[model samples]
Target: MKNNTPSTAHLKGTRTETAHDGNAKVWLNGKQLNLQASLKYCSKSPTGFNWGYGGSGPAQLAHEVCRQLYGLETANLVFQDFKWRFLVTIEGDTFDLTLELEEFNVGHVMPLIETAEDTDLCETQNGPTGHGETCYFDADQGL
Candidate 1:
């Protein structure tokens, strides 16, 4: 069986685990989740990843986590909130955030995804936004 969970539509049992040693590390299922994909869209932290704060590194992590479980589109939709909600709360160096995607009610963001299907969720002029940046998705108003 594969340890890492790749991005897909069926992400019911997927899990995202983040650990902080000297730096941040993200794991999907039992394997490490890569950050290159997320960075391709928007490079945040080229050195490494971090959490417990609303910053570039955390934003990169948020995007990667969602991207790993879902896909690029969905990751763009929810990564901002992901950084604010879960990542920022991770305090201390020895933290483990095992997010069971399904149990975490990731489906709640589906409405936003549906809206995304009709309208482009990433409506930023500069591209995907980082933490504390304007993560708005709309023609007029935004999220």
Candidate 2:
């Protein structure tokens, strides 16, 4: 049978487990950023998986993802289980990003599978948001 978790299968690399606390911090170039950021896995939702602060969409979400995933040469992030904090500078634009994990929602983390009917969610400059409706693994449960 196919697995039911998105965190355990999609991210194929070294990862560490963290405790859920609803708060954490991410940094870049020795600078601190957002503190109330949330991240949740949504491997089973229609809108596909999304990571953002509060209910903000695409642009903000893209920045949040890139912040944590981006770095000068490498990006080090501390997954405080229930929260994420990071600093993001899109190419040259700078911004502080925070993500909050809500109830470990699986549907919010899955990437949006491209459908013939639905066009990809486009950002002004960030290309595809990668919120595709299918995540081979769960972001909450490590592999």
Candidate 3:
């Protein structure tokens, strides 16, 4: 399938770093961010739709880091399927922020997929309802 994700180069500047002390520290325009916090923010599903996965976790974390670093309203991520390469952009300059999973202890916070009924409700003409709700086969139940 074709990837439709947009670029983040229009934000501000790029922040790059490698994993250090079990966390990745990112610097952008002299501001600093601890990626451990980013992991926590991204690991949780905002919509509670799908439990965060390794694939989406990094993307979400990167997007958030970009926002904090550059004060950008939006950020985007593009992933290379093989070996899990992620190309993220914020606003100004595009650069790579390398994060090694092992170095950052990513496995500890990584989300798992499981089968379960979705207790979340949806909006309807009358109100919120679960009449047509379906079970989530790959959801994170722990979170």
Candidate 4:
């Protein structure tokens, strides 16, 4: 029996920013995001944001912003499960920051396959045996 299963795959992409007037701006999927402005917004929120003293803070903020902007569950899962490296610049100062996801398990579920087809539906008479019948196969039995 041949197994056809989808495995967890890495969804990776890059976000690059150019420094201008002490701020860095990046265009992601045609949407422009300002690094400094996002950080400021997060910081000013009532909950408050800390880019941690250890320097992992900015990267976390960036990931969260990306997740919010691009609402894809799979991409968000990858972001939360993988370490991401970001290149940020501030007033000519460049920082290479690494962000790691908290340990967690992603449940795997077998996908349902639809093998039964309506063989009664045929387009042309040039089918098997010139009978205009569609053929369906049972791969497991090699029929």
lDDT of each: 0.57, 0.26, 0.29, 0.31
| Best-performing candidate as measured by lDDT | 1
Encode model 4's per-residue lDDT on 43-138: one tens digit a residue.
222222222222343443444443443232222223222223322332223333332221222221111112123112112223456532223344
Model 1 per-residue lDDT tens digits across residues 1-143: 11233323221112234333214556655567566655676566665567778977787777777766656666666777777867787766545445644433344465655465456454342444442232545666655
Single out the weakest 10-residue window by summed lDDT for candidate 2. Answer: 71-80
In model 2, state the lDDT of residue 32.
40
For all predicted structures, in order, the TM-scores are: 0.62, 0.21, 0.27, 0.26
lDDT of 2 by residue, 54-131 (tens): 222222333333334432111111122222332122221223423332233233322222121233222122213655
The parts of candidate 2 lying over 4 Å away from their true place are 1-25, 28-62, 66-105, 114-118, 125-143
- Cα TM-score of candidate 1: 0.62
lDDT of 2: 0.26
Off by over 4 Å in 4: 1-22, 35-37, 44-61, 69-143
- The model with the greater lDDT, 1 or 2, is 1
Number of clashes recorded per candidate: 0, 38, 5, 1
Q: Is candidate 2 or candidate 3 better by TM-score?
A: 3
